[model samples]
Target: MVQNIKTNLPGQGDEDRKIRERMAKIKHKILVISGKGGVGKSTFAANLAYAFVADGDSAGILDIDIHGPSQGRITGIEGLQMTINPDNSIKPIEKGGVRIVTMASLLQDSDQPVIWRGPLKMKAIKQFLGDIDWGELDWLVIDSPPGTGDEPLSAVQLLPEMDGSVIITQPQDLSLLDARKTVKFSQTIGVKVLGIVENMSGFICPHCGKRTDIFKSGGGKKAAEEMKVPFLGSIPIEPAIMESGEMGKPFVWMFPDAESSKIMKEIAGKIRAELEK
Candidate 1:
């Protein structure tokens, strides 16, 4: 049987101190969150990190989606275990110019499920921020699982210096409704709402080069306006995005010339502008 990993619970003096010391080295931190799932949030977080790297900044991704950690696969580091230094600090896995810390990397088996409670999940997140040797990074993009729950709440409360959050949603009413809630959640927690991203907004037919509103586009922008947050940009549905995820390659890096990639880069630029300001 695999041994259970013990972590210091939040609010412990030493643990909180370590978290602050480590986070201080990072210039900026961003939380990528969504109100509901299946809106391409994790994928956007990975690509955003890659986008920052492409723009000549050092980036790292902290995947706090403890239950469904996909950054390991999304960043091309699947099945790779994180190592420990002589000092007992955990080392994050580096891939494609972005350092990654995810539960997927630590799992002995990829198929194994993380059956953890709220407190256990919070402890694990604290360990990720405090115990890992992240070094200095220009951006630490945290990919949080959907909803206003344990993972997102823990990260925000821990990283008080976080720059802001990027809410992701599809261009549909249902997704927009939850996305509005996410914006409100960020506001409630005192985290800046950097903007909202509309992913899979439209589909581009490769054969005819015609655009189709597969998900009925424009709801994200409308919601952003209604919520008084910036509307970052919209990403169209492209086949290569899925392929890139499966191949462990970031879509923006793999297909820089593609329309979707361009939009993602533009979104990244907007975020940089906001954070740098």
Candidate 2:
């Protein structure tokens, strides 16, 4: 869970200046968000960071899922703790091509619950943005909590210059509904909708190399077309992704040639191209 920010809240004017000062050093800030939970959002964010890293760019990840911080584990920095620098800024934990900060890493125990109200949650997220020493980075990937609620909204509000948001969903109607809601939320908030990534669109059988659309397919493509957003690409559900995540190793690195890894790499490239454009 997030640290206590209620007592140490900053003055509004000063904090805004500090936040802009900090963000000025970062080039691109992209948020990976979903309308519903359990859609592999964190995983996508992690691998995307790794993809940028693999491309020789400096990247950082701000895992803003206050209640359910999974980027710590996904980025293989689960047990790591943030330290203080000479300037008293909280140092983000470094691993792979990404430096990371997550509420889970601050917990003394893994099972601890972060029971916080809206104000407190907002304060903590602000601190993560204004207080962390992100230094000069090519990309800052924010893994936001599900829904159009406080956490995700706070990230959008805090980073006014954020590049865009990537919506994630599975190939199912229920998931597509949430995905559409997310797209609308981004549009309503006036943030750019970079594109949509259809995760878990199908399952690839390891033994036979055969593909199965267990969740039914093309829903994400259809939804994106209807919504007039660019459809980034589809990532199939492979056993390797699950296995690697459980082992605290990002699959894109562990299985560089795997089908899903290639898909994620392509998506990352597309995002870079969009940012360039």
Candidate 3:
């Protein structure tokens, strides 16, 4: 028979207090989440943070993906170890004008699997929030692993005063079905749904400037309307977006002239307006 595990670990109260104190310094907190993976959620999170930074706000990305952390690689800080301050607080790595913390920096090998259970994953996320020296940031974009699981739950429970969450979904029926669940999950947990982003909404031909509905567009906006949440905007699929990530650069910052970049900037601006209001 399986034995019961204690819910309260040692120093749990201390960590909770520390988390509150640290989070208080950040002006706005946004969680980027999806119902399932492979919808460019992480990419959107990274670029969203950069977009805020580009608009003259200090931003940071706390990658809580745990088992599949990609912000380090996407932000171009992979393989860089985090430093500790004399006061014992962990320092976040700064790159491309945004500070970042990810499990990627803690791993000895890139291919090493996280192999952690729910409670263990929660503890790591807590430490990242409470123990890290995030300093004063205008925005903290949290990139949570897809689904309404342990990592996202832990973050939501810890950050009760968070601004809201931005749900990322593709423009397809299968993805839209999961996106609806994601919206309901936010509601069930008492977290406000800031908006839904239709990523990979379409493909823009770079050479001929023709638009192709590769994934069939407008589903995300329709879902947002049905659910009564704001529809942030759509980001088209662009070759440059993929290349920018591979090169450890955010597309919005690296290719400001690209159409995708302009749309992302508009989305960021809407979020900023909502929060600043």
Candidate 4:
């Protein structure tokens, strides 16, 4: 993807300086974060980057979920390793229209644990922003690890001009409680909260053709209203979404014509509109 750059990108000396130089080419950056795990935050981040691809814009997924980096597998680029460029910078692996950068590519084994402390993780994240040759991108969608931990904080601190954050949550109260904390974290950091996405909002029985509140519905929207943030959209719990992930493809692409995909697209559209403002 970086075949046209003629400048000899030198080795990184000062981290902050390098990140400022590299991220300048990216027009927008979105941090997909959640307060807790199992909220499908990474999956949403992957699909969102690909959604931009479907819209004919260049995109990249930076899976900063250090310990559980899933963007490589989710974007169908699992097992692909990062290549070193002649200028001594690491090249991001491309799949379809999205460039994917993940700790998954750096690990020798898929099941190997990261086992890093805060300082180490922060260094790795710094290298991701500073050393990777992301080139010019319309969007850089980052999948931050759950909670307001070092990974997420490091990402926010690195991107001085980050567009904002996209918070993900489920329909239950437990998730909502933590989601509120997420909103507060973004505010405390001076980063704007772009919106919230309610994932696994409802489920439709494939056989009965009936909808069920498997996880209890409407809490996400209610929370957004109470928090005074934009509730982007709700995504139904479709079995195909899970199946698509297991098969290493995004649900939005596998079921582009389905109801879930439409909702996701609408949410993506809403996010784009808000960002363009």
Q: Which ten residues in a row have the lowest lDDT in candidate 4?
A: 1-10
Show the lowest summed lDDT stretch of 10 residues, model 3.
1-10
Q: Give the per-residue lDDT digits (tens) of candidate 1, residues 208-232.
A: 9999999999999999999999999
Candidate 2 lDDT, 85-173, residue by residue in tens: 99899999988757899998889998989999988998999899999999999999999888888887777777778799999989999
Instruction: Give a tens-digit lDDT track for model 4, residues 87-179.
Output: 899999988778889999999999888899998997898899989999999999999888888887777766757788999999999999987
- Between prediction 1 and prediction 4, which has the larger TM-score? 1
What is candidate 2's CA lDDT for residue 97?
A: 59
Provide the TM-score for each candidate, comma-separated: 0.95, 0.94, 0.95, 0.93
lDDT of each: 0.89, 0.86, 0.89, 0.85
RMSD of each: 5.0, 4.4, 3.6, 6.2
Worst 10 residues of 1 by lDDT: 1-10
After TM-score superposition, the amount by which residue 242's alpha carbon in candidate 4 deviates from its true location, in angstroms, is 1.0
| Collision pairs in model 1 | none
Put down candidate 3 lDDT per residue, 1-277, tens digits, no spaces.
1111123223458878898889899999999999989899889999999899888999999999999999988889988999999989999999978999999999999899999999899889989999999999999999999898888887877787778899999999988898899998887776789999999999988899899999999999999998899999999888889889988999988987777888888999999998888
Q: Which of the two candidates, 1 or 2, achieves a greater lDDT against the reference?
A: 1
